[model samples]
Target chain A: MPSLDKTVAEPMIVFDGVEKRFGDNVVLSELSFTVAPGEHVCLIGPSGSGKTTILRLLMTLEKCDGGTISVAGQSLSHMTHNGRRVPADEKHVRDVRKRIGMVFQQFNLFPNMTVRGNLIEAPTRVLGMSKDEANARATELLDLVGLGDRIDSHPTQLSGGQQQRVAIARALAMRPDVLLLDEVTSALDPELVAGVLKLLRDIGSSTDITFLCVTHEMGFARDFSDRVMMFDGGRVIEDAAPEKLFTAPEHERTQAFLHAVVDR
Target chain B: MDNLGTFLSVLSQGLPFTIIATVGGILLTIVLSFVAGLALLSSSKTVRVISRIYVEGLRGTSEVVQLFWIFFALPVLVGFQIVPIWAGILVLGLNHGAYGAEIVRGAVQSVPRAQVEGAIALNLTPGQRMRRVVLPQAVVEMMPPFNNLFIQLLKSTSLLSFVSINEITRQAQQVLVPRFNPQAFEIFLLLLVMYLILSLVITAIMRTLERVAAARVGRRPSARSRRQATGAGVA
Candidate 1:
């Protein structure tokens, strides 16, 4: 496994005073966090506590109503224009977004595309890799995800676990610096969740990619994440090492949330 | 029997015009449908407004009225005459294309929002996302609706006779109404059978297309299973 301590001086992801709202409902209010390179950070919260929104914001799938987001030391919410910082343009967002990838709760694989096609699409289209190069990368990733035999099959043919693995491979194929897992295994059957979680664990241990994951599986959070942040009401209530956060939550809200999760 | 043979030959003579107009109009409809469908999704308000206008303008009016206006009234206004056959094709194409555009828009929109988010997460350009991810899935949804639109288009071609284009209906009225007035009933029955055959052929073709599209998405049932489910060879 690669050393997790060789991160650059700057953080890989930064959300400073981010605020997000959907109509009258506030999803994330003044939420802020920093993730170092090669870290595995897990976000755990009740439903609609804004955990998923954090990942979506980082992926640029959703925009923040206020505050700035920076990825790899570059402005994601705004771009420099004439020595002034203005809201980022589409091109700037696209350029900044190339460094990130996301796996969704639904797996969300392209049913029309073969597994190989799904894995190679972004690499070839966005990264401009040659077809041969993309194919080779896809094959390797499929093998890593234990879906090498299913490369030619469409996503609809795969089981939910297999589809989620393919979705993981598809995200990894882009060689993103930051990978967002938005409740990735939440939609999987109970028996199928372990395999996907184990695959993610292997990826986290074997690669240098930074993972920011939102998941309800407390066991996986304890096992896979270096840090677990307890969230409620669109704010991080407790941020601690997994052992500390899971075993001895300091805040009353964190204790109540953990008790609720563990009891259920 | 002799009268039946003559009626068949006369209707066959007009088959070329029906075939030409149906094929040309459908091809034009497909093109305009895609253009208008994509325009509805365009970022520019002008493009969206123009698409709305085209779809609504054609959809709101009567097909016969549009055909007559294009064939009869437009020539007087523009001082240039279009051949009746071409005019029929143009009107049918524009009219059906307007309806088909709604199908395209609805199918495209029906593609799950998560699929689009997955594409965006990969940092694909908007065009790449649509072409590579969204459209492939949306095309499957669009195919079934397109089949419905195509049959409607086929039936609409029968109205082209109003513009003096001698399609099957016109041919039946021209030959049977005057020459063999007493056998008008039989001639009309033959016309009905011809239209039925055309519709059946179209249904078969569209069914095959739908199967091929379903197979692409891995939704195709196995041949054995399909046969078992439908109880093939039961009769």
Candidate 2:
């Protein structure tokens, strides 16, 4: 495992007073957090508590209704190109987004592409890596994910666990600084969950890249997370280190959620 | 003998018109379909409403009515005269586009939203998502409906003759009415054969495209191919 404790001078991501609402419903309210470089934070929440929204906003897939987001010392939701603090444009968003990668619950592999193609696509197209270089990286990632033998297989041909692993490899092929996992193993069959979790655990142990994972797996959170946040009603009700938050949560909602999730 | 020559010459003349209308209509339809389909999925409500109205107005009217509007009313309304053949081509293209629009919209929408989110997770922009992920899958699903629309467009080209566009049906009528030939049935049968052959060619081409798309997506081979590959499954 790499040393996550090797602290950097600047934080990697900052969400300052973020607010998001949908019509009459509030998905996130005044949510503020900062992830230092190499920190692994797990967002544990009940459904519709805006854990996934946090990831979406970071990816700029969803726009925040209020507040500023900064990634790598740059304002993401706003821009300051050439020393002028102006609203960010499409190009600026694209530039910021390139440094982040996300994994979905459904695996969401491109059905038109083979496993190797999925792994190589973004690195070649978005990152400007050559085909040969992308291919070599893809092969390396596939081996890491334990899908080296299934490199030529299509998404549908692989089991759910294998497909999610391919998706993880595809995300990693971009060499992102921030990786978001939105319940990556939730869609898999129970028998398939262990393999995916093991792969994630291995990556968590080995990489210094910041991780923001949304999950219900208490065991994985306890083992993998440096800090675990329990969210309820679009607010972080409990935020603490894994041992304190999981075993001695401060709020009733957190206690109820942990009881419900951990038992099964 | 003279009657036979007249039939052959007139039929040959009209054959070109039929080919032109059908092929030209298809090209126009694909363009319009893509435009209208994108409109339906537009983020703006006004754009969506406008697109819906255009599709409804065009698709609800009959082809004959559309032809009349384009050939007769369009000249009056706009104070410009278009050639009859051009009018036929324009009307057929615009009309077929409405139906093709529905196919494009349906196929694009049928793709699960999760697939789109996945693309977003990779930080792809809207344009990249459409080009790389959405459109490729939508195009494969779009083909089946497009095949039906194409056949309908082919048959509808016959209506062009009502506006003096000189398609095969009109030419055959011209020959039989003037010659008063006893072989009317035979001439019509030949016309039917020509249409059948054209439609069959189109169908064969569509099947080839479908096969290519399926193979690109890594769909399983047909039972025949499977059997051949496995040496008749050790029976």
Candidate 3:
């Protein structure tokens, strides 16, 4: 286990007064938060409350309308130019984004590639790892994801749960410091959901990689997260430890939201 | 009956030229289509504008008029003349290539946003993303449309005969014009059969390629069959 004292020395991600809007709709307003290294944080909310948008922002998939986002003490949304901060250029964003990996809700594995090909692609092309080294890393990651024997299979050949696991392995192959999970299990079969959740729990507990997840699985959130943030109307309405937040919530919206989720 | 022999002899004499023009035109079309399609996606406004102008200019005008412009007008402007066969190849290539660019652009654009996002999340450079991920999938979608375009290009080669290139159609006209019988129907029917055979050959080749591409992408056999059915019907 990573020591909490060491993990808190510096924050891994910081969103300062972030604002995002799509045309007429505001997705996130003045969203601010810090994720410590090795910390596992979960964002739970009703649909369209900007839970996935937070992860998308970190991955640089979506740009913020206003405010700065920093990863590992470096500005992701801005570049420092001669002592002044301006919007980040493509090169700057690419450099900062190299340290982050995202597993999407749809398990968007490359359909043209086999499982092993998907795993080795970025490592060889982007990271400039040797073919042999990438192959070895892919083998190890497949083993870690418990799909070692299935490395030759195409993503379409796998079940949804298996595909999600391959996606996890592919993300880990980049060796990112921060892993963003965006409703990773929401698309899975009900019976197949637990197996994937168990794999993620193992990954979270065993690695020092920081996790920022958006999920609807309340039970998994309660058991796995170091902190649970309840979002409503594009803002964090409740932020607390899972034990306290799940049992003794402070915000009315949080209670009502939990009630609706539980009833479902 | 003697006219039948003359028709066959004329068609056989013209067959090589027709085949050469079609093959050369198709090859040039493939190259131009990709160049124009990728230019349409370029970040530079100038490239995008230039590509759009080329695609629209060629696609909007009649191909036969364009061929005449190249064969007749271009030589006066440039102070040099191209051979009739080369002019046919150039005009056919550019016109079909312009139409083909749309197919390439549509296929590339149709790749799911999620897949592109996945590539971006891996920090693949824009070039690497397109080459390794985007194009491989786009090529699968492109094959059927490309087959259609190639057949259209092949048929368009018949227009080259108007420019005094001795292709099948030109030879058939020569056989009909001097003969007293003026057996135009028999000669034209033979020309039609020749075109039909060429189209069927192209369809067979493209279907084989589509199946190979589909296999590489691991497309399901059922989906492959459905696509093949539609693809054959379109061809």
Candidate 4:
């Protein structure tokens, strides 16, 4: 895990006073957070507490209703070149988005593709890598995720845990500067969750890609995260070292929520 | 004897048109349906709303009325006349396209949002995502429904008689109306057989396609122990 000094080396993502709403309901209100390069930041909260929304905003799946988001020292919510704001164009968005990869709660493996195909697709398409190069990288990723034998298999042929691992491999194949994981193990059967978590843990240890994870896997978060942000009502209620937040939380909501999750 | 000879000649002459219209209209319907269905999902508000209205309006009305409107009324409305056959085919295509649009949209949308988001996460552009991920799944799910619609469109082409296009039904009507021949029943029966055979052929093709597509997605066609096929061997 990265320490404060290592984090101070450079900020990879910056969210400044981000505000998002759905009609009258505000999902994210004046949210400010940052993830330094090589840091793993875990976001935890109740179901509707905007943990997923934060990741979505970074992915450009959802736009912020207010504030600016910068990734790799460039604006995410808009296009900027040399500190001048411009209308976000497709090319610009694609360029920015190319640097980020996300793994969804629902392992959205391409049903039409083999596991190998899923991993190679982005590399061949977005990264402009040769087919041979992409395939080789896909093999490496599948092997890394412990599914080398399943590379030729379609997603439906694999178990849920296997599919999620493939999804992570597919994300990693992009070699993204940052990775967003949204409830990566939420949809797995209870028995299968550990395998997927272990794969993510392996990824966290092996790569320097900054990870922003939204999850209820408190155990994994506490072990793998450099920092943990506890959110409620779309605002951060607690932000501190995972050990401090888990053992000696300062807020009632954080303490109660952690008890509800961890004590179970 | 003389009437019988003329009837055969007329029916023969008109047979091609009937086959052509139905075949052409059905093809057009498939294309239109896929396009309009995708149009409804456009990120632009104008495109989505326009496609929605077009689909709703077309699906709501009778096919015959739409045929007449496009073929007969459209010339006056647009101040330029189209050939009757062209109008009939076009109208059939539009009407079917509207219905098809819904099937396409529903099938595509039925593909879980998770899959789409997955594609997005992979840095796929919208077009690549649809072509590579979403459409393949949607097209698989849409096969049965689309096959049903195609068969319906085939039968619906009989309505072309109203616009003076000589299709199978029209030829039959023309043959029987003047002579009052008892063989009308027999001839109509033959037409029914032809339709039945056509529908059966269509069903077979669809089944084959379904098998091929499902196999692509790693589905065993049936649970009964049959020899498992290896890879898609040249559809």
Candidate 5:
């Protein structure tokens, strides 16, 4: 595990007064947080608490309506243009987004490509890795995810657990510094969920990659995350280490939320 | 009209022209279909409007009228004349191309939204996403409707007769019917047979294409398999 030193290093991710909304529905308002390098932070809350929106903004899938988001000290929400704070252009957003990878709840593997094809496509086309190098990367990563035998299989042919495992490998193939998991196992069958979660825990433990995960799988959050931030109405209502937050959450809302989740 | 004489006459005088127009028109149609279809989905308002004008303007008007206007009037208006064959192709291409744009648009839209989000997460450019991800998936849906339009376009080549190009219908009316007067039914039967053969060839080609495209995306032709794949996929 990498050291979680808060001092003597620039943060890996910073969201300063970030605001996001759709039409009249305000999802997140004045949200601010910082994630340290190599720290696996989980965001947990009620279903509509803008947990997934946070990941979407970080991935640049949706632009923040206000404030700024920075990755490793580079602005993602805005770019410096002739000394003006301009909304980041496509080129700027793509450049920042290159360092980030996201896995969806749906496990959106490219149905058109095999497991190996999914793993190597972006590396070859976007990152310009050599074909042999990309194939080698796919092999190593598929083996890491315990999917080495299924490298040539199509996604639709696999069980949900296997497909999610492929998605995890696809994200990691990019070698992102930050991996965003938006309810990765929520779509899995009951028996399959544990296997995916176990694989994720193994990956989280072994890698130095910064993780900002959004999940309703509270047990996995407790076991896998160093820090868990309980959110309500887009604000971080409670933030603490998993041990303290899960067992002795101070806020009434956090206590109540945990109770509701644990009961369910 | 003697069936043999009609067949030989159309083959020598009009068959070449018909083939040329169909081949050239198909090429034009495919190009326009993709260009306008993608433009319809463009983020730019001006591009969308420009493409909409082309699609609607061509589709709303009659192909024969447009052919006449391009062949007879366009030269006077623009100070240049188009050959009869080129004029037929342009009109036929633009007209079917408009309908084809809708097929392309709907097919592209049918690709699941999550699939696109996945592509974006990998940091692909919009163009790359369409080419590498979206189109490959959408092409499976396009082949069927595109086959319909291609056969329709082939039959529509008979319209080239009116524009002074000696395609099948022109030879049948002015030459074959006049010479063989009482025996015209045989000539029409032969014409029908020829068209059926062409349509079947189109069906064969499209089926082969659909097979290749479906395999690339791992989509089997059976609807039951599609249902199961989709049901378990997103839900």
Candidate 6:
């Protein structure tokens, strides 16, 4: 909630020609994008289109082989040292990463901790919040997520929808300025996806947190996102407001992609 | 009655030595297991190679041969000699410590990749992720294998008899009972019973440890254990 930087006009996230590869297979090639502060942006495309790789790079789970990524005006991949820009060190990456939080498709909750324990873990350990303060904040977040009554239960005890909800609460506990969501409901049962998406919709409407989401849920993209970018084979073919992009896409690839997706 | 008294008294003389070797080996094996286990997963290539050498070297050789070398040749090489009992303890620790290290390595790796990613996503430091996330789960996975190693180490204690250490097996071997003829079968039977009891005790202890560890990661206690815990409270 504190001022993220000296200038409020800067975009919350900027990817300038970022490239990533695994051996001979290229994942993202010269990927360029940006999200304005408090804007909710969604990337939609077929599987293996490099949408999720974009989220992973922003999360610092994978490094880009070329170009730079910046969050809240602080460069994630490189930093200026003594007036010369160089690759960021571990400490530099971690310092910049403190502002970002990610939720995976798998709902990767720590089995070793209960719902309350999961929520309090980062707030107390990384932020140095006292036990009492963390517990109180955890209670607040649980209430926000509509799981206040089940704080003492372990993750395995919860349904997939409930578990993903707790995963969302855990990410929010960090008070992250940028939240990267990677197909958060993809692993849920078909019956459970609607509940998780509705929760996300509520959070998106209520908060000013910058969101960069990679999801296959075209409905959520159309209803909730400020802008939707269509990706194909690691490149964005079209980037436009959700209404325009979904209803009247200009590119042939975008039109065909939507046709295939919507028909299914 | 008189012969029975003599048999019990002679065997009891070596009982303390047998217990000391087994217990000492267990403690030593535990420490080395963690050290080598963690070193196997260390980031530095040198650390991993050094741990591999210790693990593979001990596992590849025969236990008795290793024990004899440590007790006999090691002294000549190092220009000093340890008492045979201490040497027995050291050899047992090193031998089983190898298997224990592999068990540890497997458990640590078995922790899901997603669990680690969740920790990193939370921005917890590397040490925190291992301690608060990976190890608590891995320790539960280690209990069963460690139980097996502890029993094997207990049986290995009988090897100490070769170094002139007075223990159960040595006493049975040296016993003649010439006036009453050989009681070798009787002594051997008694030895089997005694070791069975020891193995069961070790198994029970490990079971309790496994249950406690599983509970830490949120396993529901079974009704049987819950009743036993309550009964223990009452008693």
Query: In order, what lDDT does every prediction score?
Result: 0.87, 0.84, 0.89, 0.83, 0.87, 0.87
Off by over 4 Å in 1: A1-7, B221-235
Rank list by lDDT: 3, 5, 6, 1, 2, 4
Top DockQ prediction, candidate number: 3
Give candidate 2 regions above 4 Å deviation: A1-7, A81-84, B1-13, B39-57, B60-62, B65-87, B177-197, B219-235
Instruction: Please give, for residues A79-123, the per-residue lDDT of candidate 2 as tens digits.
Output: 876878889998888888887999989889999889988888788
Per-residue lDDT tens digits of candidate 6, residues A151-249?
Answer: 999888999999999999999999898899999989999999998899889998898889989998999999989999999999999999999999899
For model 6, what is the alpha-carbon lDDT of residue A185?
Answer: 88
Off by over 4 Å in 5: A1-8, B1-13, B222-235
Report the Cα lDDT for candidate 2: 0.84
Consecutive 10-residue window with the lowest summed lDDT within model 6 chain B: B226-235
TM-score of each: 0.94, 0.86, 0.95, 0.87, 0.92, 0.92
Residue B216 miss distance in model 4 (angstroms):
2.8
What are the per-residue Cα lDDT tens digits for candidate 3 across A167-251?
Answer: 9999999999999999999999999999999999999999999999999999999999999999988999999999999999999
Can you list the residue pairs that collide in candidate 2? none
The residue pairs that clash in candidate 1, if any, are none
Q: Is the docking of candidate 6 incorrect, acceptable, medium or high quality?
A: medium
After aligning candidate 4 to the native by TM-score, how far in Å is the CA of A154 from where it should be?
Answer: 0.8
User: Using alpha carbons, what is the TM-score of model 5?
Assistant: 0.92
Clash pairs, candidate 4, are none
- DockQ-derived CAPRI band for the predicted complex in model 4: medium
Kindly list the per-residue Cα lDDT of model 5 for residues B1-235, writing each as its tens digit: 3268546656457778878888899899999999999999999999999999998998888888988888888999989888789888998899889988988998999999898999999998999899989999998888877877888888889988887888877888778788777877887777777777877787778777878889888876656323322111100
Q: Which stretch of 10 consecutive residues in model 3 chain A shows the poorest summed lDDT?
A: A1-10
lDDT of 6 by residue, B1-235 (tens): 4466666777788889989999999999999998899899999999999999999999999899998899879989999999888898999999988878887898899899889989988999989999999999898777777877888888889988888998877876766344445666666777777777878888788778879888878775446543333111100
The model with the greatest lDDT is 3
- How far off is model 2, as Cα RMSD? 6.6
lDDT of 2 by residue, B82-200 (tens): 98887887888899888888889988888888788888777677888888888887776766567667777888898997888889989887756556567787778778877877777
lDDT of 1 by residue, A1-264 (tens): 113453376799999999999999999999889999889999998888999989988888888999889988777888888989888899998888998989999988888889988988889888999999999999999999998899899888789999999999999999989999998888999999989999999999999999999999999999999899999999999999999998888999999988988999
